[model samples]
Target: MYYTDRGIEELEGRRGEEEVSFAWLSDRLRTFTDLNPEFETAVDRLATWLARLDDDEDE
Candidate 1:
């Protein structure tokens, strides 16, 4: 559930050509969800942050 397009690209770059694995994502999701039960809400916030980063990179 990567948010922004660029952020997804960055993640892919780091992970290489392989598709993101469920195990990898599950671990991260578990961490975030444990911290806050509203996982979807947190992801929306993350998307906004990534959008800002993309805008900043353009400037």
Candidate 2:
């Protein structure tokens, strides 16, 4: 498994049962990017990808 999968698994194990809104997730992403400026582009890309997941045009 990929190294990142460990973090993903840890997240799932820690908070999988919690329900959160996109707004909440967005805020958390923003906070993370604020603290980790180097990851800004990656966070933005992830946000855009999540935002477009339901768009047929993107597919």
Candidate 3:
């Protein structure tokens, strides 16, 4: 498994049952980026990808 999968699995194992709103997730992402400015581009890309998940345009 990819290294990132460990964090993903931990997140699922720890909080998979919790339901959260996009607003809350957005706020958290913003906060994370604020604290981790180096990942701003990655976070922006991820947010864009998630926001466009249902779009027909090719990635």
Candidate 4:
């Protein structure tokens, strides 16, 4: 397993049963960037990748 997989697993394990709105996620991401400026780019990339998942799926 990759190092990042631990973080992913923790996320899934902790919140897998929860359902959240885009606004909630956006706010969370913003807060994350505020606290972790260095990770902003990775978060941005993840958001962009997620935003385009549908487009990719249709291809």
Candidate 5:
């Protein structure tokens, strides 16, 4: 499997670390595995979102 069970569990843990809802995490996770063709887009979006939030908090 491209994403092993352990990988999925690890992904869940990473998702929790984000402090966001499971639904949002799940949606974003679609980018990590083989679930979506737009994986890169999802990753870029999350990166941008987190960077913006971090910047705002630092201001």
Candidate 6:
């Protein structure tokens, strides 16, 4: 029911079956940040979290 859910659903509907490289995804994130500077912090947090998914520091 959240506002972002719609975007998430649209993304799933549009590209759920597609496979992309990390580099491509990074570029896309960069482009999105460039276009939406306000969301840069959120994007940076997301990227950092994703990059550390395998780290064992926190459970």
Per-model CA lDDT versus the true structure: 0.71, 0.97, 0.98, 0.93, 0.67, 0.97
Quote the RMSD, in angstroms, for model 2. 1.7
RMSD of each: 10.0, 1.7, 2.3, 1.2, 10.8, 1.9
Q: Considering summed lDDT, which 10 consecutive residues are worst modelled in model 6?
A: 50-59
Per-residue alpha-carbon lDDT of model 2 for 1-59, expressed as tens digits?
99999999999999999999999999999999999999999999999999988898767
User: Which regions of candidate 1 fall more than 4 Å away from where they truly are?
Assistant: 1-3, 18-21, 34-39, 42-59
lDDT (tens digit, per residue) of candidate 6 on 1-59: 99999999999999999999999999999999999999999999999999999887776
- Deviation of model 4 at 27, angstroms: 0.8
lDDT of 3 by residue, 1-59 (tens): 99999999999999999999999999999999999999999999999999998887774
lDDT of 4 by residue, 1-59 (tens): 99999999999999999999988998899999999999989999988987888997688
Off by over 4 Å in 2: 57-59
lDDT for 19 (candidate 2)? 100
- Which regions of candidate 6 are displaced past 4 Å? 57-59
Instruction: Write down the TM-score of every candidate.
Output: 0.38, 0.92, 0.92, 0.87, 0.32, 0.87
lDDT of 1 by residue, 1-59 (tens): 54678877897798777676657766776687778886767765765675578687688
Instruction: Provide backbone clash counts, one per model.
Output: 0, 0, 0, 0, 0, 0
Model 1 lDDT vs. the true structure? 0.71
Give the worst 10-residue stretch by lDDT in candidate 3. Answer: 50-59
| Candidate 4: segments with Cα more than 4 A from true spot | none
- Where does the lowest 10-residue lDDT sum fall in candidate 1? 42-51
